[model samples]
Structure formats: structure tokens, C-alpha cells
Target chain A: MDMRAAVFRGPGEIAIEDVPKPALDAPTDAVVRVTHTAICGSDLWPYRGQEDRDVPSRIGHEPMGIVEEVGEEVRSVAPGDRVFAPFVTSCGECEFCRKGLHTSCVNGGFWGGEDGGAQGEYVRARHADGTLVRVPDRHADDEETLQAILPLTDVMGTGHHAAVSAGVDAGSTCIVVGDGAVGLCGVLAARRLGAERIIAMGHHEDRLALAESFGATDTIAARGEEAVERAQELTYGGANHVMECVGSTGAMNTAIEVCRPGGTVGYVGVPHGIEDDGLDIFGLFMDNISLNGGIAPVRAYADELLADVLGGTLDPSPIFTKTVDLDGVPEGYRAMDEREAIKVLVKP
Target chain B: MDMRAAVFRGPGEIAIEDVPKPALDAPTDAVVRVTHTAICGSDLWPYRGQEDRDVPSRIGHEPMGIVEEVGEEVRSVAPGDRVFAPFVTSCGECEFCRKGLHTSCVNGGFWGGEDGGAQGEYVRARHADGTLVRVPDRHADDEETLQAILPLTDVMGTGHHAAVSAGVDAGSTCIVVGDGAVGLCGVLAARRLGAERIIAMGHHEDRLALAESFGATDTIAARGEEAVERAQELTYGGANHVMECVGSTGAMNTAIEVCRPGGTVGYVGVPHGIEDDGLDIFGLFMDNISLNGGIAPVRAYADELLADVLGGTLDPSPIFTKTVDLDGVPEGYRAMDEREAIKVLVKP
Candidate 1:
């Protein structure tokens, strides 16, 4: 069967084109008819040619949809069930997956990088039982709720991972370094996790406002040393937990500088400019700071975050400042790249 | 009163000379008449001229001795008490000290770097209640026990810090990246923490044997990729906890390469060659590994470690392969720098 999907032709080029609908390739697979999807900061990496890719490939990994078909072995999810698919697909039974580090699952792979992308009208999900979370009945028919849920696939989950990895908990003083959707999401996550003081550092006033609304106790519209100085002044010395959501070297350094001695920097930005050099080992060692983080195990955190979403306590949809259909995804990418929108959502 | 002490004349130079005996400088200070002290691997930094120093400075930080006098405010210790002083002096009431991170205490200072060194007839200890741990009665009168206890002030405690910072616990597979005294002590610390398998990597057979004696289950006398390969082969992939006890770039890289995805590298070797270049941040981020550690908070761990020593469960004295009087310290530094001794004990 034919379906409409977003295809990446090259850097700065994406087109909605006719594609073959995905079918259940294995007994553990399920095909979902995408209802909503969104653009991610990571999607811009390949779009901007920062990350190399094969041309004319499927694009996008953040999608919420209704299961259209399931193989005989798929017992937990079935046709007509509304669900959220994590960016990474996992087998659920590997040592890493069983330990709740689904991102490191032995048999896991990314939605677009290793398999078919989720921007299509219908996409096949492998390890269906372990990769998809069912949407509750109360929010099943609500488009806004579904739009908010879309980000949990990658951005929100990733931000949550950053906060948790940095040890942001009750009484923690945290500073998030970035003004993007994920950074805003991180502010929300830190608040949810009970951080006592949340400092959001960014240049854009609009995004900073969004951050404050999402529970940032303070905002510093500065970069580099000034941002670090502001954070240090706000926290008396430096924050106990720092979240680096921008992959730039300066942002990473700022995160490190603004962290208190014995603090942790949880980095979730897909690193781009840090190939030739690493962080200052001597400085980090002298401060007794810890550097930790990676791609979020979204599958592991989806259920708990979903509880907060369904409970009506979280409304992350405000991050979707722009909306587009499958055909307008090209413009959606441009809007995000140009900083005109924090995130863009698509209704297929 | 005049007393003899070792003084650093310049790089690669030391001399025994008469100096005024230390007097209590603060209300919380105590004067220790040096009975036993040891040279540290860190001491070689200046002795070998790798590190610059101000001429004519006292030069040591690891010492244990009889408490000759205590300031009026000192409550926990008094004259005649035998104690082990940590390398860092901290005010017990500071936030960092109260949190058990004495090394980062607001009013903390390095014994040798910021104050008078320990290889002297008498040394003043600030914040005595927080920086010094009293030696048990049975071990106080025994010179052999005192020699064993001396290492806990720095080398052994630093190694223990590496293990703990790397999250070494029961059943963990660990690797120690150097075979120096501190690395050998790391093997002991890992074993004490219940690590299932301890791999000690180095080129020296003598130090490797000592590592095995200290509880290393495996030893790899190789460097770089060969070291990583051997570690991978033993752990089936990579070690869960890696203790980086060598500050060399090659050893640090090997430590990073041999760590399992999601594992940690606890580095305690005062970083030297890593100033211009850092670790591979992209690689570390992708692998989900964490880097943590710093100078050991010996004061925090000294009491617990001393219990193991007095209980006869640990004997770290073998690390002191040579002994010298105060006048022989210059030769002791030369012996250590020339690789003739693992560590040197100084009887003042």
C-alpha cells in the first residue's frame, strides 16, 4: 500500500512524497498509522548537514499514532490502540533493557537511523510490546493532549534523563543550559523532580519566559562567562546539578563552570563541535565534578512521565509554537532552524 | 625552638636544615611532632621538576605524629595523642566539610601547597578536629603499624576515593590503570568494597605483584590498546569501574577505552598532560560513561580505613619500600625518582 511520508533529499531539503506503507516484518512488529508527530532539535542535525546521512531517506522519530495492525505475537498492543513510540526500539528482554536502560538494549536501534522513519503515515515498530506505551482513555481523543504527548517520545524524555542523570532531586539547585524545547522541558522536569531552585540560561526572552512558566525559578539571558557568573551569583557559588541541552562547546563549558564542586553535568545535546577536544579533565577533577549522560532511555521513562501527562499536571504543548501538516514539514524544519519556533508539530 | 626539617631549595633539590618549630596558628590548630611521614607520588611532580615551585618551601603533606600541643579551642584531641593528618586541612563546620567533602571545604587548604610541609620535625595542623584522625592505642606504639597507617593520609585514601567515585561495589568488575602505590591501594580498596574481579594494569612486575597481593584477581602488563583488549577479554566487553591512577594521557585514554558503556572512570592521578586536550567527549557521550573523582577526602575515610588497619585486615606498609631519616630525605626523593623505591618513609 502507498503512504505519504517526509523524505530527506539533502541538507535543507525535505519533501513529502509517496512511499510504501510499512508492514509487520516480524512476529514482534506492529504498524502504526501516525496521527501526530513533531520536529526535534536532533532532526536539524541532518537537515543542516551537521550530521551526514544517506539522501532521500525517511525522516523523523517523534510520533504518536493508532496501531493499525499487529503481528500474531504482539499481545500487549493491538489495532485501534493509541500509543506513543519511543525514539529507540528495544527488545525489552536484553540485559540493558531489563535493567531499564532501554537505550542500550542489545537489540535496540533508532527509528530513522537504523530503521524506517516515523514521519510516514504508517510506520513499523519493532519489539512492539517494549517500544510503545498506550495512551490512556481520558486523553485518547484530545488533540492537544496528543500534541503534548508527542514530545515525550524524545525531547521531554531526554530532558527528564538529563535532570535525573544530574541528580536533580528535592533541594537540588539546578541550572539548565539551553533555551530550546528540550531545555524548557528540562526546566519542567527539574520542577517535577523537586529541584529547589531552577535557573534557565538562554538568550531569547520568549524561550526564557516559557522556561519560567515551566518552573524555572530564574532566567539568565546570557552566554558563556556571563551566564556562569549569573548562575554562580544566583546559587551563592554554583549549582549542584547542571543540564547541558546545547551541544556547543561554549554551552558545555558554561555548564561545567556553573556547577558546584562535587556537582554533576548531565549532557543530552547530541554533541556536534566536540570531536577534536573533550572537557577539561584537570579542572573537572580538581572540582570533584562528574560528567555523565547520553541518549535518553525514553522507553524507560515514558510510563512514569505519561502518568504525569494523563494526570493533567503537565502541559508541554506550549513548546509547540508552530503547527504544520505532513506537507509543511519542510517549512517546519526551517522555522526551528531559524529560531522562529521552539518546536513544530505536524498533524498527519 | 629550632628543629631539623626537609626544605625544597628548587626543582630537583632538597636539603635538611634547621627551622623554627611550628606553633599552633589558630584556635583549632594542633602542633604535631613528626614521628612518621611518607613521600607521595605527587611529591615527585616537583622533585622531578615536572611542576614548578617557589624555592625554599617545605615539601610534604602525608604525615602522622604525636600531638605535641593543641590550641585552646581544640576539643577532640590533646597533647600525647597519635594521629594521622589528611593532606587537606578543613574547618569541620563548613558546609562542604559537614557534607563529608572535606577537600572542598570553604576554608580548606592543602597542607604542603598552601602551608608548611609535613616532612619536618614539627607541623601545624589547622582545623585539627576535622583534619586529623587519632590512631588507635594498640597501633600507636608500633612503628610498623604507624608506617602502615601513614599511607592512609594520602595514597591509600586517594585510591579508595577512586574506587568509591567509580561506584565500585559488590560484584563489580574493575580495572586499576596504574601500578603505583596508589594503584596498588586501589586494588585493595576495590576488594574491600566487594568488587568481584579487580584487574591491575601496569608494566612493572614488582608493582603488579604488589597489586595482586592487595587483591587484584587479574594483571595485564600492557599499555594502550593492548591493555584495553586484555581488559575487554577478561570482562567479556569492558570493566564496569575503572580507576585511573596514572596522570599520563595514554593511561587516561586506556581507562576511557576499557570502560563499559554506562560505566564510570574514577580518576585520582593529579592530571598533568590533559590540560590542552581533554578526553573524547563525543565518544564518552555516545558510550554513556561518566568521569568522576579528585583529590581524596582522606579525613572522611581515615577513621573507617584505620579501623580495618587496627583490626589487622589491611597492611599498606609494603608500599614504603625504603626508609630514611630527616637528613636522608633528599636521597629518598632521588631513590623514588630513579624508580629504586615505591615509596619512602621518613623518620623525623
Candidate 2:
């Protein structure tokens, strides 16, 4: 079978090509027919060559699909099941999975790192029972809403992990140090977790407004510790929880600074390692704050978030401001890279 | 009232002379008649003039005394009460005291730093209700037991804070990366917190034995990551909690290496700053581990520990390997500085 797929040929250039369709290989694997996919900031990372893509590779990590075929070992679902796959693939029975730490499973590989791509009409997914979350087919009419739900595969789940890892509790005051989709999703997670106050920091008016819509009680229009100072002033003394989403030393510092003594700072940012000021052990100790947070175990949250979306408890659709066909996915990356769009949804 | 006390006239020498007795001050303060005191490694830092210290300073930070006089507002205890004062003085009215974070209070001051000494008889204590814990009068008969309890004022509390900050839980493996008094105290704290297996590292056999007595189930004779590797071997993979009590860059690195993926580390050692290696952030994010711990809020835990001692639940007396009179306090510092003694308890 011939399938349309978005292939990243070079920097700022992606092309829709007719690729061979996927087949179920592993007994626990499934071949999904892609219906909705979204462009993440992480996808833009390779598109701008910030993460350096040398060879031609498929682009999307956030995608929801219909399981057209499943291997004999797949007991949870059959043909025609709608599901969202985790950004990382994992074996169901590893030591990590037993502890519900699926993201760092020893047997798992990340989508962008290896194996296969999700930005295609048909893609092979291994360990289907563990990696894919089944969604209701009735919601297919609202693909943007479903596409929004797809980010639960990575960003939204990651945001939740940040808040959870930092031990954000009821009535906690939270400071989110970035205005990206992950940070905005952090605002959503903080709100869901019952945080009393959320200070969203970003320079862009659009992103800040999106933060407000997602449950940021206040917006700090500054960056770095200046933003932290604003959050501290608004929070009275300091915030109870701080989520660092931007992978920079500046953002990391602000995350630590905005949190009060005995508070916890959950940092989800992947630092590029320029100014590594995250080495402030002295300050962290003297202030009596706990710092934690890292890669999100998306597989752990997929089923619950899918149920939440279908139940109408959360509508994450507003994050997707633009939509593009498979061929237009290349321009979508450019738009996101240039800050012209918040998020882009890709229909295959 | 004339009292015989040690006066630090200059570096390298202290004179035991008749000094005017300390009297009542603030309504919330108390006058403590010094009975037993200890020479800390930190005290040596000032005594040898290795640390920036004021000459002619009365230099003692660890002491247990009897309440000779209590101000009218002192409601926690009355005159003739046996007590132990924390190294840091804290005002209970501050925002920090409300949250039980007395160490970082605006009105908090360190003993023998900007605030004068506890070396004198009838020492003046500010905010007495918040800064002092009543020692059981029964334990006063056992001078050695009380002497061993002296380190609990600062070192023990600091170590406890390290483990507590890292969130040490039951049935977990922990690694203590220093064999100093605080590190040995960490062994006790980790044991009290229900750590199933504790691995302690140091160069001395006597200190190692002390660690074993204090509840370190295993001992590693090496330093740095080699010690960490051995701890990992003993614990199967890595420790769930790691305590860094040695104030050096090498010890910090050891603490980082001994922790498991998604584990927590508590560092109480004052860091000397070595920032070239990006290992800290890398271990934190890539492994999803967290690092916490700092200066111990001694005032917060003194009462509970005093209760523990009084209730016969804990015996911390084995830590005091040497005891000397007030005149021998300076010699005690020299002994600890020269590594001839594990800890020295001074009786005034």
C-alpha cells in the first residue's frame, strides 16, 4: 500500500512523499492509520537543525491514529481502534514499567531518536498494548481537538510530570518559567492539580494570553529572575512550586528563585549546556528547596488523558492555532520556528 | 556573679579566666549556666584562624546548659530547666518561624559569628522559647551521654535535615559520603528514617565503626565515585538516597554517582564551588533524579530529638570518643584538626 508521509529532506524543507505502508511485525505491535498529528516545538528543533538532522527523517512525534491492523499478541485492541501512541516506545514488562516509570524504560527508544516516525499515513508501533492509548472514534469529527489531545503523548504529559515530580499540591502557588506549549500545558496541569496561583512568564502577548486561558492566574512579561521576582511579589513571599520548561540556565535559575524556602522546583527543560548555572547547590540547600523533574513518561498518562478528553473535562484544542495538509507540514515548521504560529496540526 | 570561662584572646590560644556572668536580656530570652560543651571542626576553623574570625572572640558553638534565669515571657521552660541551645538563634515571630524554617529568618544569627559566644557561663540566649530544647534532667547524670548529645545541637540536626530533605523512605538504600561527625550523624538519621541498607564511606576505621554503630549496614573504605560504584554493587543498582556530608567538590560528585535513576540526594556540606563538570544537571535530568538538602534547621528538630533521647528510643553517646574540661577545649580542637579524635566533648 502507498501512504503519504512528511519527510524532512533538509533544513526548513519537508516534503510529502508516497512511502510504502507499514505492516505489523512484532506480535505485540500494531499498524496505525494516521488521521491526526501535531507539530511540536521539539519537531521544530530538528527542522531548524538546532538538534542537527543530517539524514532524511520523518518529523512528527505527536500523532493519534486508527489501528488498521494488530498483531495476534495485541489483546487490548483490534482492527479499527482509535489510539494515541507515546512519544517513546517501551516494552510492557520492564523493571521501569512495573514501577510506572515507562519513559526511562531500559527497553524503550524515543521516536525522534530511532525506530520509525509518526508523521505518516501508516506507521508500525511496537508494544502496542503498553504504548498506545485507545480513544473514542466519535470524536474524529473534531480532529483539532483530537490533535490537541495527541500532545498528551509528550508535552502535556511532560508538564504533568513536572508538577507531579515537584510535588505541586492543593493551594500551592506555581510559577511556570516558559510560555511554550509545554509551559502552557504546565499551567493546565497546575490548575488540575489545584494550585491556588500560577504566574506565567513570557514576552509574547499571544503566548502569555494562551497561558492565561490555560489557567495562569497572573502573567509576568519578563524573562529570567526578573520574571521570578514578579512572580515572588505576586505570590507574597515565593511560589510553592516552580516549573522550568525552557531549557536554559536563565529559566532554570528563575525556577529555583521563584520557589520559597521548603518549596519544590520541578524542571522539565533539556538544557543545551551553555551557561550551566544549574549548579547552585549552595543556594538550593540554604533555601531548603527540593528540585526534581525530567523526561515525561507519556505512556503512563495517555489512557487517563484520553479519558479526560473524551469526557469533556479538558479541551486542549486552543493550543493548535493552525492546521496543514501533509505537503504543507514543511511551511508549518517554518512558521513555528519563526514564531509566527503557536502550534500546527498536520492532517495526513 | 563571677564565672570561670574560656576567652579566645587571639588565634591559637584561649585563656580560661574569671568573667562577668551573662544576665537576662529580652523577655523571651534565658540565661544558661554552661555545663557541657563541644569543640566542632567548624570551631577549629575559627580557632586556628583558618576561618575569618575576630580575635578576642569567645568561641563556642556547641553547648548544653541549665536555665539559671528565665525572662518573664519565657513560657516554654522556667529556671532550673535543663536545655540545649541550637547554634543559630531564631526569632519565633518571623515569617520563617511560621513555616518552621528558622535557619533563614531575617532575625536569625549564628553563634560566635555576628552573635557572641556560648563559651561563657550563664550565656544569654535570644528568643529562648524557639531556639532551645529542654534536655531531660536524668541524662544530665551521664555526662558522657550528654556530651555525645552535644553535637545534636548542630551536626546531628544538619545531617537529619539532609536525609529528611531528600525524602528518605522505608525499605530504601542510602549512601552517606562522609565519615565526619555530621556524616556519622547522617547514618543515625538515615537509620531512624527507616533506610533498610546504609553504606558509609571514609578513610578511618574508627569512624567507620562509629558509622556501623550508628546504623550504617555497609561500609566503603574508598572515596569519590569508586565508593559510589561499591555502594551500587551492594545495593544492586544505586542508592535511593545519598547524603553528602563532606564539604568538598569530590564528595559532591560521589553523592551524585551513588543515586539511582529517579532517586534523591541530600547534600549538607558547604560546597567550595567547582563548576566545570556539567555532570550535576546531566544526572538530574537524564536519570530523572533529584538533589536536595542544606543547612539543618536545628531548632526545628532539637525538641523531638531531645524527646527521643529522654524516652530512651535513641542512644547517641558512642559518637563522643574524647572528653575534656573547659581548659582542654582548645586542645580538643587541635586533636580534631589533626584527625586524632573523631569528636571531642568539653565540660565547663
Residue A20 of model 1, lDDT score = 79
**Every model's DockQ, to 2 decimals?**
0.51, 0.44
DockQ of 1: 0.51
Residues B60-167, candidate 1: write the lDDT tens digits.
Answer: 898789899999999989899998888888888888887778888988788753346899888889888888788866667997788778899999999999999999
Off by over 4 Å in 1: A1-4, A8-11, A15-22, A54-57, A136-138, A275-278, B1-23, B46-57, B136-138
- Would you list the clashing residue pairs of candidate 2? none
* Model 2: lDDT of residue B1: 64
Q: Tell me how far the alpha carbon of residue A113 in candidate 1 is from the true structure, in angstroms, after superposition.
A: 5.5
Task: Write candidate 2's Cα lDDT for A147-166 as tens digits.
Answer: 66877877888888888877
TM-score of chain B of 2: 0.89
In model 2, the Cα lDDT at residue B80 comes to 87
lDDT of 1 at A98: 83
